[model samples]
Target chain A: MEAYNYTDIQCPPPESSEIELCRILYSEDYLTNMGYMRGIMSKNEYSERALALTEKIINVCAAHYTVWEYRYNIIKDGSNHNKIIKDELIWSENIILENPKNYQVWHYRQLLIIELVSKSSDDYNVEKEFELIDKSLIEDSKNYHSWTYRTWLTKHFKLYNDKNLSFINSLLKSDIRNNSAWNFRFFLLVNNPENYIEQDRKSIINGLVLQKELKFTENAIELAPQNQSSWNYLIGIYEKFNLDINNLKGLSLKYSNFEDDKISELEMQPIISSVHALELLARIYSSSKTTVDKAIRAYDLLATKYDPIRVNYWKYLSSSLNTT
Target chain B: MVSLPCSLKVAKDNTAKIYDRNGKYHGKKQYNEGTIDDGELKFHLKKHLNYFRMLLNFLPNAFQSNDPIKMSVIYFNLIGLDLCKGVEEYNNKLFKTKKERSIIIDFIYKHLVESGEGFRGSVNLKLPLVDRSNEMNESLKIVGNYDPANLSQTYFALCILLTLRDESMSQRIDRFQILSYLKRCQLPNGSFKPLLDIYGKPFGENDLRYCLIACSIRKILQIDKIYEIEELKKVDINIENLYEYVLSCTNYEGGFGGEPFDEPQAGLTFCGIAILKLINKLDSKETNSRINYHKLVKWLCQRQIWYNKYNKQELDEGDNGIYDNGGFNGRTNKASDTCYAFWCSASLKLLKLEKLINVKGVELYLLNETQDEILGGFMKNRKSDYCDPLHSCLAVAALKLLDSEYVRELKDIDESLVISKDALNFMEQLKW
Candidate 1:
């Protein structure tokens, strides 16, 4: 039980003008501990005490990249990485729960998982990782870090199964406006790990899967007419597959009927139409010479009443259609 | 359309007289007709200048957790000062002498991790220059080996140096090493990590932000020239895959997400488009085919919050507030935020569609709602009382892009770079 000789690093005096609030917020004891840790880190001392100090430092400043880097280095240099990795995983889960929005914690977790997999793939539990990420997502469904990590894990582990799709489906069922879920659905459909080849993915999407997804999206749109996520999903499916917008023309007309008489009175008292449906009808009509006028009328209505915030955009679209 | 409860009267001298609904005088300003409250709206340049100056000197305890990316905070403050046309005056006050200027220059350079070949976010990891040279060779070696340089920090440091007009920046910067660092940070999938581990493995979130920063660093340092040199070819990035990665992030909604299969966001959309513009692939056939260009423009335009009551009712709950009528939101079904004004507008500006949105509406929203009249600096939203550097800098930059009468005093910004046009010109003149 020898005492560790702490180095004396000159910390800025409390009264110094350049002292950042980050430093000022630190207690004297905390600052002293950090100074000692820094002294050890500078000397490249990768010991148990140094490793323990990193934990102490990280608890306070989870976003501190340097401490995370130091901790990773210590674990990398350790003799028993299996034990360290397991312990760190459990430790980081708590840290992540406390700071779900922290960029550094998720990254550190990624590093640890990558390291663990590299050492012994059998020991790496994909289910546990999923549970952790799912818990994080439950806390905040739109958490960008959590979603990104989930996507990365899916691709990395090739966990493209019913579980993944059902998870996304449940998310959508709860909140159809969750664009993140819609985006993930697109990713799952197109970049399914099972279909490694582009041709395979194309064939899969062109099959009954495409019809099912389209129906699901259209139904979601019907439930919430203004929800842009479902509309974007429908549009994404069509554009990515090069499907004709005319296919949705029947559905588009259900929400917006742009007849000659209706177009004439759009300026006086605009009909209550779904903005998305009107835009879709406009896109569909602009494709053919016979219906181009109807497209212009739709754009005019959108510009004047439905979506006046983007009047210039609608006007630009109408003008472009005219030139074509 | 709901008319504002105000009217404008123009005089012979181009000065506008603003009156309330009752025709009582409100204020007078040098204004143009048709612009919303151009006569009464104020830029509050002096107040914003003081705000930036104060932030530069010291950030409050509220920013305690942001200690790691201190360079970026400095970058935001410096850019804000530049936007306010206060950089020269502030520099004169802070760095009155050559020695003082060199001290700052030296301080920034100290963050450079020699072994990592990039700049660390802060100087906390590395010992002081005197200590490193005299008594801490072992510590210095460890710091050099273990200290990771961040992509964003590297970008921020380079920009700060350029803003300071550091003549020797090109010479002082180790271009080859930094390029090597960038090369190491790139993943096999063409996305980039913000930092590398001690083992030289890129480990961090792979997002559009890092990709954008990586591209910016490459452009600023002119790393493409490395390919001309036989030995330096290893430092070059995979431009083809990088382009593919950026295009892959394009959402069906026409905006981009942080990563592929993520929700399209205004900030990431800007980064994605800016990356393409920087790499000269914006108009490539692949880009034209991969992206729905018209849909992207429509999506960006859709970000503007309108004053219409019907549209407000249709929008997400809690977004019915009238104060955000002209501001832009980062995503669909989201409330308007101060930064998205710059993000969406700049994205449109890059697409050559700046005129597609109502610039007057944006100006009015920033001035009347988000701009903190008493404190200076812009808030995140109308309801926010606090103003930070990010929102304030972006609000000003967004205004500068509009080149409206309200922002006539502010210097123009290069939309893609988000730096003042004059500063960009100065950077272009540098030897690097």
Candidate 2:
């Protein structure tokens, strides 16, 4: 399906080649674009004339942020709630589908969402936001725009629960290294989750929430032993609280695959950055240098053998061990 | 796969070969077998000089795909030339006489909106929306209406002018106007937006990128160094809030992202550290007290991805890639690209940890692997044949970080502006 149908809005051919040359030299589209630019530049009153101009221009060019900013001022100042804002939401969806990476399109849509919610949040239709994000994220799983907007929707409209966690869980199952989903899971489980900040600080990450997150991440790590996202989630949980670094030694050792005598896994080497879990385990043994010596050596082996590119980083870590 | 040009052949022998378009025997050419030393490969100065000069031809499609980023393409293309050829030499070649420099400066300055210190992507193209001759009275209507200015473009324009400025170049801008624009664009939270609305509130999103742009502009204009802005305009940087906003963007992973608690990225990490360095907030004592320097340094070093110099056909079985060329990636496990070499390594430089990187490997990657053989511009990656101005510009800058032989001719670049120390000196010499 075509994302945006600008056929009706495209500049029609001039009457003849002479006018077309004139159009090329002094293109009607250029005039339209510059008119909006000049309006925003001069802070001109966004009259009905400016409104018509914006409608025509945004029809063809949604990336012109100056035009969008001008249109925002015009609508907000004049209180033009005459159904244009709703149409703008639909138009923004078309733009988003056409150009998912265009940041300005998402920003414009967000401004429209704010306008609608301020008028009467009950009619905001937040499911549209969810659906729009779903489509965008499906296209690019690492898109922070959709993830950021998802956080806003959850905070403003209470759109998260076990269902959201389950969806993210399915995403992680599909690709165990989807960092965006892992980050979203942290937001839901930990700090400032879904208006949870309004409640007492202690209620933010209560025992149940922490337990569930630990279990979820532990299972994820078990499923994909080499996925850095799983390890990052485990470390993220440890860092979120003022928990002792020593406490994670148990989880680290649990995730460790020292006993898995798999040759195929040995050939397909683990990533260098993924050895943070092993390093954390080494650190846990740091109280006594003699006790930590073996784990530290294991860390070196992982860093050097699996990820030879970052031998310098491994050397740094090993040297710091002696100093500490 | 990108469609190979007709004259090129994807040879079984690894190196791409120049061939006749038709299926015909192409004459044998000797392939350089051994790994070339980084010191041996001279900067392809003439080809790069031609590469950037060709961009100015405006071949009707030179910047067609980059229509939205017109200012950036112009600014970085000029910078790419300046890095390959000396800035003064480039000045002599592009604009010889004083009159010529003035003309080019005015062309850039025309993009500046009168309301603020910002500049738009380009001069707003005038279209014949209304028949000015027939439908309107020439005397009654307004003329010379232009587009609004933005933070990124303003940053590009000011630096471009400063680089192009010499002794005879005049300071045409009112510093107070630009300073006030930057000040007003700051939100209560201290991060900067791209532009401010008519209400003096921010119009767009706030991020580390805008913050860096604002601070870099501050450094170039030397708003603090100049005395006039204190009385003429309110020139306060909500220091408390700004510091808090920047600190908020710092991640537990020892890198920064666009927002607090977001995914850590190399580019945003550069912006954050560069902002701190620019504003004189990068105190090692206070910052290291909180931030894990070991992790941060380790994280930066790990951004060096495995970049094998040899193609598949050239690689022997069981080769461990010990002597492969190295390049920086933006994220933890992403493919290496040209721009992040500057972003990641420059941040490491600011952190006093540049020594940890494999300098020789990176220099060779920038000079040999990523550089296009035919056009002399850097591509997004080793595999890409297309030339991107921003990538080419940053690769040259990253090459400077490696202390390449070109350093003697090129200007010394500080971490913040990515400009020649000489050009920055020239910027400092400008009087309001």
Best by lDDT: 1
**Tens digits of per-residue lDDT for model 1 on A1-324?**
344545554433222223231122435555666666566666566887777778777776666676788888889878877888888899999999999988889988988988898896465677679788879888677787888898888888877767888989898887777777887888888545456345646766657677888889889877777677778788888877888889999888876655533554323333544688889999989999998998999899888766776778889999998887
Sliding window of 10 residues with minimal summed lDDT for model 2 chain A: A15-24
lDDT of 2 by residue, B1-432 (tens): 111001111224544332322433333332334332233545676677677766643423434334434677777877776766545665576567767666666676656666546687655421123334553334434332324457888888787877776443335676667777788788888898887654455777778899999888877777756545566434656656777888887665567878776767889989988888887778656665766666667668867755222112112221112222377767654556778889988998998777667665576557656777677778877556487778878887887876766545665676689776667788887766
Compared with the true structure, what per-residue lDDT tens digits does model 2 show for residues A1-324?
A: 223322333332312211100011334555545444453335344566666666665655555666777777667656547376776678778878877877777788778888877885356566678778888888677777777777767766776665666778787777666777877777666755445434433554466666767788778766655455667667767787876777676677664443342545323232222345566666676566676686567557545454445566666667777777
Residue-wise lDDT of candidate 1 within B314-378, one digit each (tens)? 43333234445688888876768989999998999999989987876787779877788888899
- Looking at model 2, residue A138 earns an lDDT score of 86
Output the worst ten-in-a-row residue range by lDDT, candidate 2 chain B.
Answer: B1-10
Q: Model 1, DockQ value? A: 0.31
True contacts kept of each: 0.35, 0.14
Q: Give the DockQ-based CAPRI class for model 2.
A: incorrect
Candidate 1: global Cα-lDDT? 0.76
In candidate 1, the residue pairs with backbone N, CA or C atoms under 3 Å apart (3 or more residues apart, or in different chains) clash, namely none
At residue A214, give the lDDT of candidate 1. Answer: 84
Tell me the spans in candidate 2 whose CA falls farther than 4 Å from its real position: A1-63, A73-82, A156-160, A193-206, A250-274, A292-303, B1-43, B57-69, B125-146, B166-170, B226-234, B307-325, B360-369, B382-385, B404-409
> Which residue pairs of candidate 2 clash?
A31-B127
Q: Residue B429 in model 2: shift from native, Å?
A: 3.0
